[model samples]
Target: MEFNILNQSPVLNGHSVEQSLGHTTELAKLADRLGYKRYFVSEHHNMENVIGTSPEVLVTHLLNQTKNINVGAGGVMLSHHNPFHVAEQFQLISHLAPGRVNLGVGKAPGGTPLATAALQHELRSDIDSFNDRFLSLKSFVDGTHDNHKVLKISVDTESSKPDLFLLGGSLSSAKFAADNEVNYIFAHFIKNDENLLKEVASAYKELYPGGKFIAALSVLLTETEKEKKAAKEENSVYSLKFKDGRTLRVTTEKQVNDYIKNTDEKIEVEKSQLDMILGTKDEILSKLNELSNSCPIDEFMFHLPTADAALRNLTIETLAPIHTIHKEKAGIL
Candidate 1:
């Protein structure tokens, strides 16, 4: 199976934003040298801990730092930006890295309602508008829009468009992605229902047989019981469903409490462990193999949830494609 990385650039306690971003750059470089297929960064805003606000900017920096690995947004939240501008930005990045660029888009706001409002202050960002925005972005990127006759996304005729990916976990999202004939990545870390994953995968595959279907999972490789216990605690996430159909996901109970205190809306709280593969290197690989056997996942992208730099690096090195191949050849896998 192919392996890719989805970095959140988490800023742990006492770690500066610069340090976190630098570590991300180093990890991307490591993944590139290790024969990983792609290294994508996430988009989050208004969060003190997780700070990957601008995926396009990070993608450009990572592309300049790495050689062969495909780099792009794990996603750019389409709800917060203009489709035309999004297409143009990624297309320009594609010119810099050619086939090594990817553009993953998602329907979520990627932040709190406050941040969303701030980001979309000048745009119509209703939830129902995501489909239209995505279609416009796709058309612009593919050079199929009728307006292309009068305007172009990129002035460079030789520039290649980035490969497009839609990030979602629901069956409806699967259908949408299939209908659009774009790559689909199921966010298993967010909602870890295996049967649902299978159904979504089957749905997408039946409709778009040739499209890529990836599963992004939260994972950490641990060496001791202490680390394993801590990793497990960090693997939990709280999902709050508000009365008005707004959902908020946070990692800590403190954040959940803060949200409840700040909002007057009634919410149903559901706390679940993130579907993370946590164990030694061998055990982790075994779980991945079992998951692959059960689900029709075309690629596996690891989302290291820990803020510990050493553990993150170790996880990346342990799961590197080259290292995995070496172990397989040695009959140690």
Candidate 2:
């Protein structure tokens, strides 16, 4: 198994942006020292709690801070920018840290309506142009755009190009990724549906035939007695089904409130036992072994979403993969 950390650079209560950013940097260094494979930052806009608006900038700073560790975006929303510009930025990053950058792209807005409008001001058709945007981005990276006339990604022949990945929680996205023949990361933390994951995995494998697939999920490794009890409370997973057959796990009350505040989608709620693995080291290991045996997941990416920064850092330290298999190349493949 391969292990990597996905950081949101979360600003917990009473912590300033500088402190949160500093803490995240320290954690990325710790990950490198502990043999964690990669460090990817999340992206959000107009989110006071989530300060990572520009993943490209974060990747560059982290690349300067760490050596021999891969740094990339958890994703840059594909609809937000021109494909050629996005390709050029990451290609330059590859020059800075050759063979150590991954470019994951998603279709999510990564922000509220106002923020999306502001960020995507010139590209007004982003909402309905995700597939087209990805195709163009891929063309630019693969040096097939304009019949090789312009905007070619100029990476060294010996070095790996910026890895391109499509990230999403929906099967529609999965099929698109497989059809396009790029890597894919399934966000189980967003939907928490194992059957859905397996369904997409099967389809993607059959369509792409030995392509890379990453399963990104959350982890909560607690030690204190109070922490154990509190972690269980966080596992009270609820599902809200919308009229358009869209369903997502509502992990926090704020998510529910935001849904109600933003849209008029009539929701039918369903409560179920949480399927995630979260506990002490032994219990979590057992669950991991079982998952590895039962599922065809290529690699597991862990994200700790706790507001308690100390505990979050501790979890990464304790779960550091001292024994996971290492690959010669940089990607999940």
Candidate 3:
């Protein structure tokens, strides 16, 4: 089974931003030494706890800091930026890393409404929707913008194009990826809809033969039974804290405005679900095998939810030697 680390540059125990970023850099190096396949960080904005606001910038940082290890974005929220621009950014990243950069695009707004508004100025009603924008992004990256050939976008690199992965929680997105001949990641951690995951995996197989289907889940590798229980307890929050730094899933207008008005406002969101692989070595491996049998996914990406620095390092150290996906990937998850 292929294992990858999904990071969000989390700020543990309210550490300074510099420390959090430095810690993330160290983790990237650790992943490189561990033999994990990829180290992909998600893009988030206006969150005190998570410092990763830009994936392209972070990808560049990871590439510079690590010698080997695929470095890429778990996803770039494509809706916020221009498609050509996104393609161009990855173009540089792909050439810099050469066969290690990935451009995973997702439809969901990666931030609150306020943040999205900041990103998306001059909205166009007649412009592109998520599907349209994604198609354009694909075209730009592939250098196949369907217009005058004189105006086609090119990567200006001899290396291969960044492997494009569509991140989603629905079957429609799976079909979109398959139809477009791109990679697909079923983000079960976002929403643990088992039925949807099965359907998407099945649809991907039927839609595109030999396509890559990834199962990305939240995971926490604990050292002891006591640690496992504590990890679960720490993550088992009953309410959402998006308005504050406790969470980052706030998307509604009211919530975003409230957050903007008072960054410390304690707003609550309904139904905060937690789906993770939190257990010992044998248990994690066994659960991974079970998930493999349960779905037709081709790869597995593990997203860590903890901000505890020691625990995080322990998880990586514990899993690195035994659960390394490749002899060397040094790049991304």
The TM-score obtained by model 1 is 0.93
Candidate 2 pairs with clashing backbones: none
Write down the worst ten-residue block by lDDT for model 2. Answer: 324-333
State the lDDT of candidate 2 residue by residue for 231-313, as single tens digits.
66756766777676655555556765675566555777777655556778767667766766666777778877666888787
Clashes in predicted model 2? 0
For residues 1-333, write the lDDT of model 3, one tens digit per residue.
577888888887667889988989999999888877788998886664678889999999899998878888978988788888888888877777788887888776666657767777776857677888898888888877766266544526345678888988777789988999988988888766677877889899889877789888878887678987777666643334543233345323455455557544556665454767888877887787787787787878877878888878888777784344443244342
Every candidate's lDDT: 0.86, 0.78, 0.77
Query: What C-alpha RMSD separates each model from the true structure?
Result: 2.2, 4.2, 5.3
State the TM-score for model 3.
Answer: 0.86
| Every model's TM-score | 0.93, 0.85, 0.86
How far residue 83's Cα lies from its native spot in candidate 2, in Å, is 1.5
Misplaced by over 4 Å in model 1 are: 125-128, 157-159, 242-246, 260-266, 325-333
